[model samples]
Target: MLRNGQILFLCALALLTLGVLMVTSAGMQIDQASAEQPILVDGGLSPIAIMSGRTGMYAALAIGVMGAMAFVPQRLVERAIKPRPGRFYLMLGVGAAALLGLLLLVYLPGIAREKNFSSRWIEIPAPVFGTLSIQPSEIVKWSMLGLLAWCAVSAGDRLRLFWRGLVPMLIVLGLVCAVIMKEDLGTAVLIGAVGVIVLLAAGAKVWHIGVLAPAATPKPVVDRLNAAINKLLALPDVKTKLDRIGVVPMPETPAEFNKRIQE
Candidate 1:
């Protein structure tokens, strides 16, 4: 019988397989439509077909990666965490520099690509045909998590100390979130929350995480959030849904929202 982890992995792989099938099925109509167009006939495959193929290929790659990480020798991973002269520093330096470079690339003109009024992706040349747009923030989030774990492990018992341990970790976290927040506030907040949780799990004090609450939602941010929510609620589809449900539509004042939530 498969163990819990094995079962979970199988379930995730199944879901990924299902997603690939669905994408390909949806693309088939586009492929058929392209088949009828004489101009597009010379282009080989339709754009949707190409995208679906790429999605399946990526899903396969992801499964392989997950399997490798899951079944790799534990001792090998342990060896990475084991302390050696300049080893930890070298790892930290490389990870930090790569993350910062990717983040900075999102701000450079002609390199950063904007979509939906947000400049948060960078285009990298693909092996074939077109460029692939990637959100650096996604990669940085995982790197930051691994970096935090490395720092905590490297710190050893020093991680228990407020100055020697928590301060430096907080500093690193602050810098990462600061850079990411300029274009992706949502991702920055998510990274910050995860970093704090990891720190707490690694033995940092509770108040250290609590102190971040005030800064989590500043007045201007709350106002902007409210405005955005109001705008979204005013959209045609959203208004129709609200009307069908017979619930009062949004754009409520603070007091009205609070009252509604309480009830």
Candidate 2:
């Protein structure tokens, strides 16, 4: 039988697989709709075909990353970060610089617009590379996790202190969340959640975690709520929700209903 952790990992893997399949299906539909008639006639594939190829490439990359993590000497990882604390800081600095560069690229001229919004994507002249994009928020998530973990471990027994251990984490997490909130609220919430998990794992006091409860509750839930609100506000069904919320009554006249719907 698999251990509990292994079972949980497998379950997560299954969910990820299902999500990938759904994404691929959606991509295929989008590709089919956008394909050129000549390509369809000649049996050439569309964007989905290209995406499928890229998915394979990404899978290989994921495998390679996992292999490297698995085979990397534990002693080396420890020595690299532990013995030379400067190395950890260097890695953190490099990651932060990369994230800043990505953020700046989002505002740079000649970058292709995504959905009429500024998103950080490296634009190459070639058509095939035009769509290549990277979200700095994702890197921020991992960086925060790594930095928090390092802080916790490096603090050693001092991590037991509420101030010495938790304050720094709270500060770092706050800064990261602020940066992420500029363009990506969802990622900010996710990174904060992971940071909290790492803190709890690092032997944080229950009360310390409890102290964060009120603050934590809003981050993830509020982001989702805001997104849903924005979507609803953009839709014709918003009046229905408003009526449900006791803001207004349902209109009786067709014209009035249509007018309210347009609001």
lDDT of 1 by residue, 82-128 (tens): 76434545555676777888888987887799888888898887785
Once superposed on the true structure, which residue ranges of model 2 sit more than 4 Å away at CA?
A: 1-22, 30-52, 67-74, 81-105, 108-131, 206-263
Which is the leading candidate under lDDT? 1
TM-scores, all candidates, are 0.62, 0.53
lDDT of 2 by residue, 60-103 (tens): 45556755675678898777777233343454455455655555
lDDT of 2 at 35: 45
- Global CA lDDT computed for model 1: 0.71
Task: Write out the backbone clash pairs for model 1.
Answer: none
Find the 10 residues in a row with the least total lDDT in model 2: 248-257
Q: For candidate 2, report its TM-score.
A: 0.53
* Residue 28 error, candidate 1, Å: 8.9
For model 1, the superposed segments whose C-alpha errors exceed 4 Å read: 1-9, 21-52, 66-74, 81-93, 209-263
